[model samples]
Target: MKFFIRTFGCQMNLNESEIMAGLLINDGFEWTENPDEADIIIINSCSVREKAENKMYGAIGGYGKLKEKNKNLIIGIGGCSAEKERDALLDRFKKIDFVFGTRNVIDISNLVKRAMKGERFADFSDKLNEVNYSIPKRPFSKHHAWITIIYGCNKYCTYCIVPYTRGFEKSRPIDDIINEVEEYNKNGFKEITFLGQNVDSYGKDFGDKKPKLDLLIQKSAQFDSIKRIWFMTSYPSDITDSLIDTIAKEKKAAKYIHLPVQSGSNRILKSMNRRYTKEQFIDLVYKIQKEIPEVTISSDIITGFPSETEKDFEETVDLIKKCRFERINIAEYSPREGTVAHKYFEDNVPKHIKNKRLQYIMNLQKKINLEENEKYLGKTLSIIQEGKAGKNNTYMGRTINNKLIIFQSQEKLNGSFLKVKVNKVSPGPLYGEIIEIINNI
Candidate 1:
């Protein structure tokens, strides 16, 4: 049997797809790059935004058509959207053979086996506390891999569907995570990113015996083969001095933080159920910068929420100006079903206004990015070469701070460390020429 998996949404979803692929491969199924050539197909989905759900629906429609040519092809849906839609997906899309929830990834082999026997199934059972500590993973990237140290979210942000789709926060034991990191290290993986909906909330469920995100990073740093350690999507108030200190003290820890402040307006923040105020968020950013001076900070911003006034938008603009974020992912608010914002608030923000605000923030962030990139001009920086850029002899890589750099190279230097001197800078990426290849750090 041949299988193809299409992944959507965040890093967690991608990692789950990899795990599913590994499981299928171990169960005597061949992996196929083309959907038409596969005996089985799975759509790993996301429901964080309505747009994401729409894309998943469109993909389902397209893939459903493939069944006409091959009636025996088994179609499966997994991840957040599948978890949200459940059996309803099978009812709506008659071509779908099976559906599984976010927590049912480990049972994929069985799901496929059952589907092959002409038995339809929808496994939405709660397996939040179950930990697959040593499941094999076929990572898409050879040099870097995502390791889930924690699962789900408890924040219940008013505008997010994550809490409903992913269930409550459950953390993996530190020793198990470290063992996985060691496996990746032994297999020549250079970078390992610890993933979670709210990485800062890791180990909070364990009461007094809680092992914090800092401790997890500390343990992963013990692997000598791992060149970079990173984590993401931190809750603002949950960030501690210890976590900041760990990033600063650990030589392998990447100097990049993806701390999302959804909005800068106090009213919007409260409406969105974000626990931190604008003042508190600014203080946290400055603190992180003070400790890790070379750190690059990125954020997420919503353009127009329900009843968001011009003053609220201006406040967000002011916050961006003050913080000078190196990168900002700006999105126009789209109310999702089952979220507090959708249930309690009116989606009255005009589409044009929302788009206008989003564009303005995008332009502002591009300017800020250019300013940040300018600081590296004429400076030699270390980069882990990612791969070829397909233009002449150009190769692409990222600095320790997660800034993208495109440099000229004569050799395929993927997974190698090299020093590059930035000759030019753009809002998008740095342009440089390779200086010297470092054999070891």
Candidate 2:
């Protein structure tokens, strides 16, 4: 049997899809990129944004038409959106055979077996204890892999749906994470990212305020095979001095921080239930920059949030100018059902207004990104070969600070680290030529 998986959302969702594919592959099933030839199809979903939810629904409808031609085709939905609307989804779409939650990925093989036998299933139960620490996975990348250091979120930002869908914070033990890193290392993977919704709050669920992510980074750095360690989607307030110091001191830790500050207006932030104030967030960014001078800071910004005023929108613009983030993921706010904002606050921002705000922020950041990338010109930087760039003999790799550079190389350098001399820079990506390949760091 052939199975096809289409993933949507963040990195965690992508990793979950790999786990599902691994389970199916181990069950005597083949993986296929073309859904038309597959016996089973699964959509790993995201519900953080209404746009993502709509895409998943549209995909289901389009794929559902395939059942008319292929009577034996089995369709499955999993991840945040599926978990969020488990009951409604099955009732809404007859093509869906099985629906599994974020924590229910371990039972994928069993679920597929039952699904093949014509038994419909929806398993959204919390399976924190039942998860296999060393579960089988078919990683998407050969050289870089994501090890989920923590699962779910406790922050429950008013505009977010991750907490309700994925459930509360449940962190894996340090030993288990290290073991996963070792597995990736054995597979010749040079870059390993510690992934989570709120990575900075990794160990708080274990009943300790200690930053276990820092400790995990420290342990993962000990592996000589791993060249870079990275973590992401940090909660601003949870970032500790220890975490900053650990990133600075560890040779393998990637000099990039993805701390999201959703909105800049204090009043709007408060309305959105973000714990930290704008002033505090600014202070934290400055501190991270001061401690790790080479670090490239990235952030997420949401415009036209509920009850946002022209002043609030300006405040966000002002924050962008002040921070000058290497990159800022800008989004127009859409009220998601079951979130605090949806339940209590009104989605009062006009759509046109949201679009205007989003565009302004995007243009501002594009200018800022170009300014930042210009600094790399005429400089030699270290980069690990990620994959082919699809342009002639050029290949793409990321710098230690997470800058993607395209450079020409004749050799197949998927996992090898190399030095590149930057010859061109733009707002999008840096162009360079490989100076020398580093066999070992």
- Looking at model 2, the pairs that clash are none
- Give the alpha carbon lDDT tens digit for every residue of 255-299 in model 2: 999988988899989988899999999999888888996898999
TM-score of each: 0.97, 0.97
C-alpha lDDT of all candidate models, in order? 0.89, 0.88
* CA lDDT, candidate 2, residue 320: 83
Model 2, runs deviating above 4 Å? none
| Clash count, predicted structure 1 | 0
- Model 1, 1-441: lDDT tens digits are 999999999999988988999888887899999999989999999998888899999989999999999999999999999988889999999999999999878889988999999998898876555556578678888889998877888889999999889988888877788888889989989998989998888898888744498988898888888989989878888898999999999988999999899788999999999998999999999999999969989999998899999999999999999898879888899989889999999999899999999999999888989988999999999999988887888889998899899988865588899999999999999999989999988
Cα lDDT for residue 93, candidate 1: 94
* All-Cα superposition RMSD per candidate: 1.3, 1.3
Pairs with backbone N, CA or C atoms under 3 Å apart (clashes), candidate 1: none
Q: RMSD of candidate 2 to the true fold?
A: 1.3
